[model samples]
Target: MAAPIYKVAIVGRANVGKSTLFNRLISEKKAIISDIAGTTRDRNYAVCHWRDLEFYLIDTGGMGEKSKDIINQQVSTQAIQAMAEADLILFVVDVRVGATTEDRILAKSVNRHKTPKILVINKVDNNRWRQNNDDFYRLGLENQALVSAANGVGTGDLLDQVVTALKKIKKKKSKKNGEENIRTIKVSVVGRPNVGKSSLINTILGEPRLIVSDQPHTTRDSQEIIITHNKNKIILVDTAGIRRCSKKSGDDFEKMAVEQSLENVWRSDITILVTDVSEPLTWQDKHIIDEVIQQHNGLIILANKWDLVKNKDTKEYTNYYREFFGFARWAPIVFTSTVKKLKIGELLDLLVLIYQEKHRVITDNALSKLLADTIRRHKPTKGAGTKHPYIYNLKQTRTNPPEFMIKINFKAILHESYLKFIENNMRYKFGFIGVPIKIRVAKSQNLQDK
Candidate 1:
């Protein structure tokens, strides 16, 4: 089992740069940063790896005596949960505006919980406001507020303080709850609306944890449920139904939900494309698969409602998979009915197998030799084939959407089909099932073409 990750909560009112701070600290724009208040409705979180330490940074909803939207309720609940689960809480504040009546209420709430918090004053763009943060001491968090987050002013010292706080509060061992030696695989159940996606998850989990109905797009946020199979943990993330981008229209709430589901897929290690056998592959199904490809997450296609398929075939089933999604020819396809719970355990086994393949790494010696033989068998017809078409080094630049950077000795451009051939060969040999691969060619002289 992987170690229990530390959680850092960013709690503050909406538009207080909580998301900005989370993005800045992680050195990546994982969260959507916008001028609009309540852009992040829930406690948006992303795991950050720093040196030997790994921790999750959470962005909470803005707190106040008043929040009207249904999304705000979700965010507030998530923020409260974050505080309860945090190894450390960074209470973000806006130093430029100082403190307001709402800020006072939020501060009192934090004080009531008595969670160890670091008062972080944000938007202190200049020394004037940087010095003004001292006034925020009245919030009762005497630790002092740091003027930071946007433009990263006073961030270096803030990070040092954060690391020091983390060291003090972080647990040295994994959660004993995982007392068994088992691997937990995060599986995302994804598909178009009204495809029984939520029903499938609630069925596997043996309860109606997810609010399931006949309504299309019933699930708004990605909800999680854990199931253990022979001591191995399987995390089920039941995502909202994915719709075609072209189909996506107004209703701001719906857009946010779809975005959240996509974000969930990005975090998950493997995704199960749930579809109705009656409908087979639709444009929306292809859209979700494209996203999974882009994210480089593992894929499994579940032809749901198999019980309803009157002409279920033994041979043509594979044909449908190949003809429909040419990209995921190697992905495992399971046919079952969530209503009947048929072959659900088999699906679980296949999910674990797909997850294992996702983490499989190719040895340098093996990959190098394979690349050579593949190129030889299907020699890339070089553009202006003079000069023996120089080759440089081969490096696997990315995984989880397996990609490689092939440094060519010549600056000549290579054919797209040739790159596709190389990618297909890598997939055929390595069993990169349900994942898309990219091959980028660059000119290099110093690097060896290993």
Candidate 2:
């Protein structure tokens, strides 16, 4: 029997080291760390295992202050949503700053949930700071833990407390058989700033789970959300918009946010590249596409804001993307509008299909037959000083973004264009749609076989 996945949320006001604590617990730097307040505008999710217990740890944006700004309101909403969904809450606070008005306000919100919460007094690097905890205790939480998230002081005890609190809660068992064998597909929604990446995800989810703002960089961390589509489990990652701007123009927070966004492309099994259909594809968009191809994950081009575009010719936009993103010709394109909710259902269906395609494996006998037929149609060209290079064998070495190995007489003599030609034929015979195909060439001595 499989155990239920518990959820633990870390909540607090801005700059209280909540993200630092989150990183310390997850044992990875998934969240972008910054001294700037509001650096984390979205709720970041990651799995954490402690004392043989596995549960999800959610890092949420700062709440309180009750600002009238649209972004602040949305950030608060996201945090509240995390609190509502979490089974446990870690109310992190700064020891140096003590408890402020915002802390008191957030305390009330965290208290209303009836969920178990622990008041974590962070930044207690030394005994002097650790001795003073009266102000924090005033917040009225029965449980508290003092730890230095930066120096790894007392974090073990904090985790122990977390385990103890979680043990008290009961978990329900799932009745589905073979649930353990079902693989979760991680799909990352990535694109340039203000291009409706968050909006697109929100439209698909049927709720505003992320903070959608007109301002760029509203999403600084890669927020993960799990959803089931056609009985397939998928982890949707909403990443921050990437920009190719200089350091002087961008801050450290933005730089790290971009780095985290790109890292999601590598971590996910599939990537949905959101583009602004209203404007022509920019160099930055092309750069992002290149990154996805380099990672060799399944790719889906989502041309967003289709309602704003003057020309609605699907064929025109399809050909335009093919011309600009020629490097990723295998990737499928879906023109969608968040406002009109066009093609939202189709996008999810396509995602499941792409996941299946990425994991599809072709048999060696079929591959060998394809190679023989392909070579008959067009023989491999000769090198500068050599006769026609004879092909020996073709075999797929791996799947999940299928990789193939070619046994040739002289690997160096084989041109990349020919390798691409072989890949095209392979795709023609077998469908590897929405996923990148890798071909590896190796020298073989079986020239007489061909």
Candidate 3:
């Protein structure tokens, strides 16, 4: 049967980056950009054919955007309208700030909608960094797809997961097949109430464009400003601080702000998980990290307020995840003090490096030779005390996490420790400096039969 066209709406609290993702999805239809109704129906928003799914993209602003201080009311109305018409709603949340009463309110409201929804934990570039978000699970979303819309970082996986979710709910969609031209890094600074996330963002921007005050939850709604550094233009998202539930109405904007922050993460390639150096990594920090990993985005840990720490060990912060998430062995780490703005330039430089690492690749001969040598030296140990055979003749097929297809004996599992050794060997022979390596294993065909 021919597939029915499905509507996909990017909606969340105001400034949660629905517009940015919308522009990214329908960038080719520049002529149709409007404030009110480019995609209330199936005809608008040019689409991309992903796997077997066809999707029509729509965008909606937070409810009651008209009353907001900064955001345009008309645009907000469009966003709200788009969400109601969408088959699936991408609920974005900020991990650093944790969950707010506003989020619960939105969750309550969204739950009543009967629409298949996927909560996207955005601004999660680092899995090690989390501040708050687990409280959001009560929203009734069992599985959430994580993605960084900025670098296209787990976006493919997020899309795949979202589609899977959509299939289960039977909220089918069909989008017009076309090329999408969305490029630029959209970064949203979000964290626990008064965690200095805004101060850190303002510090990096070197501007007071985003308001900062001693007051908690000062900034409401998501505000974006674009700046160019190192020849790269990036969109900076300033969000209201997320806090525990307060007055019903007050919580609404703040929780919505958190949602917007999450959307910003989903729309961004990388996220700077801003945290106070002195404070312990709380549930909020952990929640933020969980969301970032969920989205597959790259993360850089920024220990803000470093000036407050007296003679602390830098190595601990640098190697925080060496024992935790083994996969983050190569994730870049940096320390910064918003008060002193120390190492700010170096941090940004590291960002460019982190962005570049995903694209690094080594030649095939070197990979194969290294793979063969590593396997021969430390043979794989299978379960039940069997030492499996080796992998030989590896060839580089792609870049970005540096994938390599290797011929190996399928009898054994590739041990993480052994994998690290091979990676070290590769880095030594051919400098991978900032990039992470991805190794693929394949079985050798029958020799005698051939």
Candidate 4:
């Protein structure tokens, strides 16, 4: 059995470079970083390994400032929750700014948790900034380290200390073998403002895990919840509604929320795009679909608020959207009402099916035969002043968003229509429903020799 993963939370006031440190530590730009304060309003989590020690790293929204706004309050609540759940907290502070009043308040909150913590003085890129690190010692934390998250200075020393501290916590492995074997499927609920994304998650959860309101942009952060249904573990991420920059009121917070929402789409295994059934498919909906396809993630077009649409011909609506979203014709569409809790269970069942299809593996023999038959049925047309395109061999290179490699002659003359035909035939034969497949074309060595 594998050892338990330690939970490490990066907590601090706004604009303290917590997200930068998180990206540096995880070695991935999972968290959106910006010069704007409160860029991160939700808890971003990722698993990081160092010297055989695997730990769950959580980059939380900035805290310490008191705000009467509902969104700001929720962000603070999420950060507090992350700190509480963490086995070890890295209380990040800016060395250049020194410790402000908010830092003191944040420190007190951290002390209340009584969890083992390390004082991380960030942005000590030079000797001048390093001198200011002494000011943070007054926070009364013994274990501390100075590092520059952006420049990668002194991070090794900080990680070494982190390893030493984590070694103290006893490992608690899962006893249930079946539970250990269960793979969690991450599904992000995404759409435009006030599309009932949070409400859908709450209804599906059978509880109000996320704060839902009628007000647009009520959910400023991406919140994640885990549930097990019929022996399958699923992680549901309720994200902020993405709005166009032109329509935006020029608020920095809203801009960051939009960026975070887009980031969540890439992070998830499947993206469920929720749209209001009453409204026609808007440009924002199409934009979200383009983002999902760009990320090569599984997609589901959810027509939410179905209960509100009166005397609507479901078939017409379906047909319209099917034609409107012809580019994403492979995505499954489901009509649901979070208010009525309609088709909520069916959505989960569909997710499981999509998850299986995304991970579906096809052998080289099967792919070779399918490609041969597909090319025979629809031969490639000759390009202007170029030889006819011929695919000599085909094989799947990877799965979980399957990718294929096709050895071809005259790759330059391979038209987009022919490639689309190949993809369509592959999907028809393999049933890659709700999954995007990538095909890479390469010059065949044997064809080049001939």
Q: In terms of TM-score, which candidate is strongest? A: 2
Q: Report the lDDT tens digits of candidate 2 across residue range 1-450.
A: 353468899999999998999999989988888887887888888888889788889998878787889998888888888888898999999999888988888788788889999999999999999778899777889899999999899999998998999989987745666767776899999999999988888888899888888888888888888888877788889988998978577588778888888888999999999999999899998999889989988999999899998878999889999999998989999998999999988999999999999989899899989988988998887555565677888889998879999877754377777899999998888889899999987886665645
Q: Which whole-number lDDT from 0 to 100 does residue 229 have in model 1?
A: 80
Provide the TM-score for each candidate, comma-separated: 0.60, 0.92, 0.53, 0.73
Residue 51 shift from truth in candidate 1, angstroms: 7.9
lDDT of 3 by residue, 1-450 (tens): 233467676656643444544554444322112233222111124354567776766545454313554334444444556567777877766555555666666666667767788787665556552334566687677667554444444566767876676667653344423313222455656667677776776787776444455656655545555566676656666655554455556444455667767776776656667777777766666677667666656577667787787877888865664444345555555567788889888876766665665566667666667766766777654433364645556677776445666565555455666656777777677755444466666665556311
Clashing pairs in 1: 13-62, 13-63, 14-62, 296-401, 392-449, 393-449
Clashes of each: 6, 0, 35, 0
lDDT, candidate 1, at 182:
77
**Every candidate's CA RMSD:** 8.7, 2.3, 17.0, 5.7
Q: TM-score of predicted model 1?
A: 0.60
Residues 1-450, model 4: lDDT tens digits = 343468899999999999999999989776767887767776777877787677888888789678997767877887888888898999999988899988988898898887899999999899988776777878888899999999899888888888888988886754666677887899999999998999998899897556666777777657677788778889998888887877647776678778878888889999999999988888889999999999989999999999989966889888988999989999999998998999988999989999999999999899979987987798876455467776778888889889998776754467777878889999999899999989887776474433
lDDT of 1 by residue, 20-88 (tens): 888888897656667777666545567766656677777776776555655455567768887888887
Cα lDDT over the full model 2: 0.87
Q: CA lDDT of each candidate?
A: 0.75, 0.87, 0.60, 0.85
Residue 224 miss distance in model 1 (angstroms): 10
